[model samples]
Target: MQDIAVGGSTVSRTDILGQVEAVGVGSFWATDEEGRLVYLSAKALDALGGGGESLIGRPLVEIFSEVQQANGEEAQRTLGFQLRSHSRFDNMIVRVDVAGDDETGQRQTRWWRVSGKPYKDGNDRFCGYRGSSIDITAEYGRQLEAAQHSQFDPLTGLANRRRMGSRLSAMLTACKGAGRSCALVMLDLDRFKQVNDTLGHPAGDELLKQVADRLKTVIKDRGEIGRLGGDEFQIILPDIDDRGDLTGLAGRIIQMISQPYSINGKRAIVGTSVGVAIAPYDGVESDELNAAADLALYAAKGSGRGLCRFYTADLRESAELDSRIEENLRDALVKGEMRMNYQPLVSPHDHTVHAFEALMRWEPEDGRPVSPAKFIPIAEQTDLIVQLGGWALRQACEDAVQWPTQLRVAVNVSAKQFMNADFPKVVAAALAGSGLEPNRLDLEITESVFVGDVEAVDKTFAALKRLGVRLVMDDFGTGYSSLGYLNRAPFDKIKIDQSFVHGCTEGGTTNPAIISAIVALAKALGMETVAEGVEAMDELALVTERGADLIQGYIYSRPLTHDAIMERSGTENFVFPPSGPPRYRAGRMNFFRKIGVIHEDHYYKAMLRNLSRTGAWIEGLAGVPEGTDLILDLGGGQLAVSKVVRAAEAAQGLKFETALIGDGNDGLMTRHRVSPYALATAGMPLAALPAGSYPLAEQMSASRSPRKFFEVEV
Candidate 1:
C-alpha cells in the first residue's frame, strides 16, 4: 500500500478509500456494455443487503424496475431503454425492490437517483458505463406528500378543484378521441350551511369526511369522485351513456347522502341535489360540460332541492324561468300578489269537514297564477319564506276567527321558518292579534324541521306547545320518515303524502300496503291520519277501508277561495260530497288547445279536451271510426300515434301507442321528438330547435283533403 500526503498528514491509499466509503455520501458503480453490473461499492452493497461479490453479474436495469419523471408521471425513457441504447443518463429517479426482513419478510421498495456516463473503447465501441447513486426514498416520500397536499382536500382526502379540473379535462379529451361517452355529476349539499352554523365547523368537517366515505362506497370502481371545494362534489363516470342507469345512480347518491348522520354525538341530516351531463351530447369540452352540469344542478335545486336532474336542451329555459320567478317572488309580498286557498279535510266516518288546509297561491301581477310548487321553494331559499309563512299564519288565524264553526285551520310552515329562533313568538302573535283560539290553529310542518340540533328542535316544539296550538306532521312518509321523529316531536295529526295515494287503489301497487301500515301506525300512536289527493271514488274507498281517519282531495273539492269558504261557513254544517271519476285511472289534465291530427293524407285540426299518460280525448273530429290510426301532432315536433277507441258526436277518445313520460314539470310529454338534425336533413337550416312549431311542414308533400268537420271556436 502506498501512502498519500494530504494537508498536514500522510494517509495510505486504502485508509483514504475507507474514509471516503464510511461517509456514505453516495456510491460508485460500473456496468459492462451489456448493462451487467461489474463493480459496486461495498457500502452500497451493504445498503442493498447484499455483498458486492454476489451482485457482480446482475443486470443494472433489472435492479431498478420502474422509473418516474420528477412530476410523478411515468417517465418516457425507461431504465431498460436507456441501458439498451448505451446512452449516458443523469439524475434519473428509479424505484427498486430490495430484500428485507421483517415480521412478514416481504420485499421493500426503495428509490434512488443515479447519474451515469457511458464509456467506450479506443475503437469507439461501447464497453461499459460508470454511475454514482444516492438513496432518495425519504425525499421522494416528502415530495409525494407535498404533491398530494396540493391535489387533495385536506378535510375529506378527496381530490380538490385543481386535480378534478385536470382529471376531467384529460378524461373528456380521451373520451372525445375514442368516440365514447362520459357522465359528469355535479352535486351541492343541501342544508349543509345549517350544520356548519349549528354544530360548528369541526362537526361539519366530520360530516364531510363521512360523506366522502359514503361516496367512495357507493361509487366503488364505477367512477371517480372529487370534492370541488365547500359542499359541492363532482363525479366522473366513463363509458356510461344510459340515462336510466345514471338516474338510478344519482338517486342512490341523493338517498344515501340524505340519510341521517351523527356528528359529535348529535344527529344531523342533510341532502344533496345532483345534475348530470353526458359528454359529446351535452358538451365536447370540460368547461362546457361542467357548465351544463352546473346548470342542470341549478335546475334541480330550483325544482325543490334533494333531487337529481339530467341536463337537457330545455334546462336553459328552465334556468331562466327560475331566475324570473325568483326575481318576481322577492316583490310579491309587498305587492299583495300572494293569497291563501283553503282545501277542506273531511272525516271519512261522517263525510263532514273536520278542518281546512291553508294552501298558499301566488297570483302574479302579470295575471298568471304561479304554482306554489314553483315559488314556495324559491321563497324557502331566502328570507322571504319567513315573511310569507308569517303572513299565512296571521291570515289563517284571522280567517278561522270569522268562521261560525270552530273548524281548525292548518297553516303550512317551511323548515327554514320553523328553524328561526322567533318562530314560536310569531305564532303567538298571529293567534293573539287575530283573537283566535290557539286550539283552532294547526301548524303543519314536514320532516325537514328535525334536521337541526336536537336541543333547538326540542326548544321550538316546547315553545309551540306552550302556545296551546296543534302541531301536525305534514307530508308524512315522504322524506326521511323515521319513527324516531314520531317519538320525539309532538304531532297531533299525520297527513299521508299524496304520492302514496296516487296508485294505492290500483292493482299490483304496494301503496295500499304502505298506506295501511301508516294508518295503523298513526292509530297506534293516537294521531289522526289524513290521506291526501283522493281524486276518485275508488281511491276514497280504499283509504277509508284502510282506516284513514280523514281524506282531502278533488274528490271533495279543489282549493276554495276565501269567499267560497266564507259562503260555506255561513251554513250550520257543511259537507262536500265526493264527486269525481267512477274508477281510479291515470291523472287527466284538461287543455282546450287546437292540435293537428293526421289521418291518411288529410290534416284535420281538432281540440285536445283532456290528456293522460295512455289516452286523450279530442273534440271536433266528426266521424273518426273505431280502430282508425292517426297521428296527433302536439307541436314542437311531438307526434303521438294513436287509434280511436271510442267515437261519439264530434268527439272521440284515442289510445296512444306508447305511454307518455313526465316532462320534469307536472306534465306528460312524448319521449322522443323531431331532432334539429332531422329537420336539417329535411332541408331546414342547421341550428338549434326553436320553441313552438316543428319544421315538418317543409318535408311533407302529401296533399291535404278538405276539412270534414267545421272548426268550432273554443
Candidate 2:
C-alpha cells in the first residue's frame, strides 16, 4: 500500500516497509503542529523503552533533551530551539530520559542521533514534523570513553596533568573574576621509588592506585585531585585562603599518605611531603602558583620528609641559594670546606658520655654558611651525597680515634649511601684506615633504607653486620613505622626523634605518650633507646622517667668542634651535668622587623624584636599602657589583634588575641590575611595583595583619635 523507491526503481512493497519497521535500527515518528507525538512506529515506541500507550500524545521534547558538550562547552543551539523554529535538523545528538545502568552498577547515559523536517499538507500549510532517530548508544559511548581517556589517568583513575592544568586555569579565571580565592597543593611520595625498584612495576601501579583512593577519601567533594605522573599529585582547593586551614589540610594529607599500604601481600610504607600555595595571595595565575608550590615542596622535602610547607616569598631566594650551593658542593670536600661537629650522647644510667653523633658542617671559601637542611637534599639530587657520605664516615672515624679508646662515634648514613653495594667496603676502609675499634664505630641509619628489594636490603644489612660496627636506628617513629623493619633487621639502639621531645611536657600534646611507647618497645626488643633533642630540664626529666637508656641534645652541650671534644676527652670530664632552662618554653624567634601598629585611629611604625606563637616583643611606641588594645599589621595584608601585657620606656610586650601560625619557612604569620575583596571594596583594583601593609580604612578616616603614645624615632 506504500510506494518505495530504491536502486532507481519504484515498486509497491508492503512487506519491505514492514521489514524496515521490524529491523529496530530506527522507525518513523510524527507530531502535530503543536509538537505533541501523534504517530510512532513499533520500533520508535521500543526506543523510548516503555509506556508506549502513555507516550501516544506526549510531547517528543519531553522524552529527550540536549546536553552540554563533553568538554563542558555550551552548545550553539538547543533541541527545543530547533523544534520551536520549525526548521530542518539532522543528526543532532540528544540524551534520553530513561536511566540506564552499566554492568558495574553505575548509571550509564543513553544518547540518540535524530533527524527531522517540518512537513506540509496538500494545501502547502504547515501540518506537523516527521523525524527519525537512530540508536547511537554504542557510538556515543565510544566518544565519551575517548574523552575520559584523555582527561583521566589510566592507572589511578585521577585526572591527568593536562586535565589538571586545564582545571586550575579554569578555576583561577573564575575565581579572579569573583574575588574569591583558591589553593593549590603539590605532593609526592617519599620512598616510593624503593617500592617500584623492590617490587615489580605492577606492584608499583597497585600502590599508586591505593594512594589515589586514599586521597579521594580525604578530599571527598572538597576539591579536585590529580596525578601529575609518577609519584607526584596535585589538588585544587576552592574558596579558601586561610593559612591555618591550609596547614591542617596539608598535615592531614601528609599523615594519610604516609600510612602503610599492602601490595601483593607485601607491606610497604612511604612518606609524603606537601606544598601549598594560595591564589590571589601566593599568585593569581596557574603557572605562577605551580612554581610557588614547587618551591614549597622543595623546602618540605629538604627539611624532612612527611612534612607540609606553605609557599612563602623567601623560598625563591632560598632555592637560588641552594642552586649555587649545589654547584659548589662538587668540590667542597676537596677544598677542605666540610667538617664534622660532634655532639655527645650520655648514658642516663651512669650520667657519662657513651657516644658522640657526628654532624656535618659546611662553610664555603667565601665565608657563607650553608645549612645542612638546605644543602643535603641538593647533594642527594646531584649524587654528591655518595661522596659526602664516604668522606663523613672516614672523618668521623679519624676524629673519634683521637679521643678515649672506650668512647663510640656515630655517623649518619644517607639512604642512597647505605644502599650502595660497596657500602660495607667503605665502612671497612674507614675503620682499617683510621685504626678505630670496630665496636666503637656506630653507623646511624634511618628507616628509609627499606626502599628496594627486601632480599637485597637484607644482604646489605648482613654485610654491614659482618663489619663488626654496631647499627643504630636514627629518627625512629618519624616515618615508615612498620614493625617488620625491627623484626627483620637487627638494630643495636634506637634514637628517639626530636619532634617528640619538643612539646613532651606540654599538657595537650600526645608526644609524651608516643615517647613512652617508643621506649617501652625498645626495652622489649632489648635495644638501647636514646632520647634526642632534650633542650630543657622538664624534657630531660620526662625522658628520664620514660626509661630512656641515653639522652643527647643541648641539655648537655651544643655540637662541639673536634678540638673542643679532645679538650674534654679525659675520664674525669666524661660526666656532663644537665644544664638547660629550668623549665620548657615554646621556641621564640628573635629578629628585627618593621611593622605597623594601630591604636585607636592613630597608626605608628614599630619594630618587632621577637616573635612567638603566643606573644611578641615590640619597640618604638612609648606610653603604651598595659591592658591597652591595638592592631599589629605584619605586612602583606596581615593584621593581628593584640593587647599590651607589659610596658617599658619605649618597648611593649604584646599577647596576641589569637595564636600566630607558622609560615612554613620557620617564620610566624597571621591565621588569615586581608582579602582582595576587601581591597576592591576600599577602591583599589581587585587583585592579589602587594608587598607591605594595607592600613584599615576605618583607621584612615578623616576624624582621627588623639594620639596617647609617642612614636620613638628608632
Candidate 3:
C-alpha cells in the first residue's frame, strides 16, 4: 500500500480509507455485470441494520429505492433504470430499507447520496460498477420539506395554486395524448367575506382548514384538490367526462362546503358556487379549460350563488348580457327608467283585493322591459340596491297614500338592504315623507335575511315593528325554511313559494301535503299564510280548502301598472270575481303566434292561438282530423309532438305527447329541444342554435312533399 504524510507521520492509503469508513463519512459498494450487489461496506451494512451478507447477491436496485419527496410523492428518477443503463450516476439520492422495525413500529428507512462509475474489463466487456455513498438522511429531509412548503398551502395543507397549475398542465397534456378526459371544477365560497369580517382572520383560517378536510372527505382519491387562493378552490378529476357524474360530484361538494362550520366555538355558515369544465369538450388545454370554468363560475354566481353551472357557449353570451345589465343599471335610477308594478293579493274568502305587492320593473332608455329577477340580484350585489330599495319603498308609500282605499303596499326588501344599518331609517323616512300609515305598509323579506348576525336581524325587525310596518316572510319554503326563522323573526304572514304551488292541484303530487303542513305551521304560529302563483280554479280551491289566509297570483290578476291600479281602485273595497279556467289547467298563454305544423310529409303554416303546458290550440289549418299526429315547430329549435284532441274547420286543439317544464321564469318550455348536436349531425356546424327554423326544410326531407291540409291565410 502507498503511504502518505499525515500530521508529520507517514500514513498508508489503506489506513486513510479505513479511517474514512470507520468515521461513517462514506462507504464503498460494487455491483457485478448483472447489476447484482457484489460488495457492500461494513459501515453501510451497519447503517442498514447488518444485512450486508444477505444483500451481496441481490440486485442493487432491490437494496435501495428512489427517495420520496417531502410531499409524499416519489422522485421521478429510478435507481433500477440507472443501474440497467450502466451509466455513471453522480450524487443520486436514494432510500435504503433497514431490516427491522423502529420503536414506532415503522420500518426503518435511511437515505444516501450515491455516486457510481461503470467499470469495463480489458476486453471492453461490461464488468461491474464501483460506487461510493454518504448518509444524507437529514439533509434530504430538509430539502424535501422545503419543496413541500413551496408546493402546499401552509394553512390548509392542500396543494397550493402553483402545484395545482403544474399538475393540471401535466394532466391535460397526458390526457390529450391518451385520448382521455379530465374535469376541472372551480369553486368559490359565497358569503366567505362575512365570515372573516364577523369572526376574524384566525377563524377564517380555521374555517378554511375545515373546508379542506371536508373536501378531502368528499373527494377521497377520486380527484386532487388545491386551494387556488382565498375562498377559491380547484379540483382535478382524472378520466371523468360524464356530465351526470360531474354534476353529482359538484353538488356534493357544494353541499359539503355549505354545511355550517364551527370555528372557535362559534357557528359560521357559508355557501359555495361551483363551475365545471370537462376536458376536450370545454377546452383541450389546461388554461383554456380553466377559462371556461371561470366563465361558468361567473354564470353560476350571476344566476344566484349556491348553484353550479356547466360550461356552455351560451354562458359567454349570458355573461356579456349580465355585464351589460350591470353597466346599464347604474344609470337606470338616475334616468327614471325604473318603475314599479303592483300585483294584488286577494282575500280568498271574499275575493277582495287586500293588498298589492310592489314589484320593481326596469325599462332602459333604449331597451324593452327587464325582469326584476334579472336585475334585482345585480343591484343587491352592489350599493345600487340601497338606492333602489329606498326608491321603491318611498314610491310604494307615496302611491299607497294616494289610494282611496286603505290598501297595504308590500315592498320586497333584499337581505343586503335589510342588513344595512340605515335600512330602518330609510323606511321611517319613506313613511314620514309620504304621510302613509305604517300599518298600511308591509315589508316582504325572504329567509336569506336570517343568514348572518341573528341579533342584528332581530334588532332590525324590532326597529321596523316600532315604526308599525307589518313584516311578511316571503318565499318561505324555497330556501333554508327552518322553523327557527319563523320562531325568531316576528313575521305577521308567510308567503308560500310558487314552487310548491305550481303542481299542487295535480293528481299524485305531494305539494298539497307540504302546503297543508305549512298552513298548519303558520296557523299554529298565529301567522297568516298566502299561497302565491295560483293560476287555476282547482289551485284556488285547493289553497282555499287548505285554509290559506290569502292568495296572490294570476288566477286573480296579473301585475298592473300604476295607471291600471288607479283605474281599478275606484272604490275603497275593490272586489274582482274569480274568472280563470273552470278547473286547474296547466298554465296557458295567449300566444297567437305563427308556427309550422308538420303532417305526413307536408308542412302547413298555422297560427298558435293559445299555448299550455300539456297542449296548444291552433287555427288556419283545415281538414286536420282528430287523433292526427303532428309536429309543431315553435321556432328556435323548439319542436313539440302533438295529437289533435279536437278538430273543427280552420281550428284544432292538440295535446302534447310530453308535458312542458317550467322555463325558470314561470313560463312553459319543452324539456328537450332540437339540440345543436342534432343540427351538427344534419350537416350543420357545431355551434349555438341560431334564430330561425330548426330541422331546416332541406334537412327534413319528409317535409318536401306537397301540402296535405289546406292552409288558410293568416
Best by lDDT: 2
Measured by TM-score, the strongest candidate is 2
- Top-down TM-score ranking: 2, 1, 3
| Clashing residue pairs found in predicted model 3 | none
lDDT, candidate 1, residue 54?
Answer: 55
Q: Please, what are the lDDT tens digits per residue for candidate 2 over residues 1-714?
A: 578788999866756654777876576778999899898777756655454546678787886677656653446656788889888899888876543333554433468788899999899888889888777779877777887788889999999998899989989999879878999999998878878877878988999999999999899999999999999999999998888988988877877876768788887777788998888888989999999999999988877666788888888998897888888888898899998999989876677998899999999998778889778878876579899999999999999999988789999999889878899999999999999989999999987777545667788889988989899999998766646688988899999999899879999999989999989988899999999999999999999999899999999888889998887875348888888997889889997878888766566789999989989899999988899998887876777889999999999999999999887666788888776447435543212234445545334443345778898976
The C-alpha stretches of model 3 lying farther than 4 A from their native spots are 1-18, 23-109, 113-133, 404-406, 504-510, 541-547, 576-714
Q: How close to the true structure is residue 667 of candidate 3, measured as C-alpha lDDT? A: 53
In model 2, state the lDDT of residue 123: 91
Tell me the lDDT of model 2 at 332: 94
- In terms of lDDT, model 3 sits at 0.81
Sum up the clashes in candidate 3.
0
Order of the predicted models by lDDT, top scorer first: 2, 1, 3
Q: Residue by residue across 1-714, what tens digits does model 3's lDDT show?
A: 589887889988867777899987899899899888898877888777744466788888888787766665557876678778888888887888755635655567788899999999899888999999999889888887898888998889899988998888989899768767888999988777777876788888898899999999999999899998998999999988655567677778877876667787776677778888777667878789999999878767766666677777667787788888989999998999999899999999899888999999998889899987789767877788888998999999988898865688999997778988999999999999999999999999987676544567788999999999999999887654357678878899999999788878789989999999999999999998999999888889999998998999988888988888887667454786777776765567898678878775556778998988889999998888998999887764567899999999999999999876543233565644454335535553322234445445345444334656898876
TM-scores vs. true structure, each candidate = 0.79, 0.86, 0.74
Candidate 1: worst-modelled 10 consecutive residues by lDDT: 683-692
- Which regions of candidate 1 deviate over 4 angstroms? 1-45, 48-94, 97-99, 103-107, 113-134, 587-714
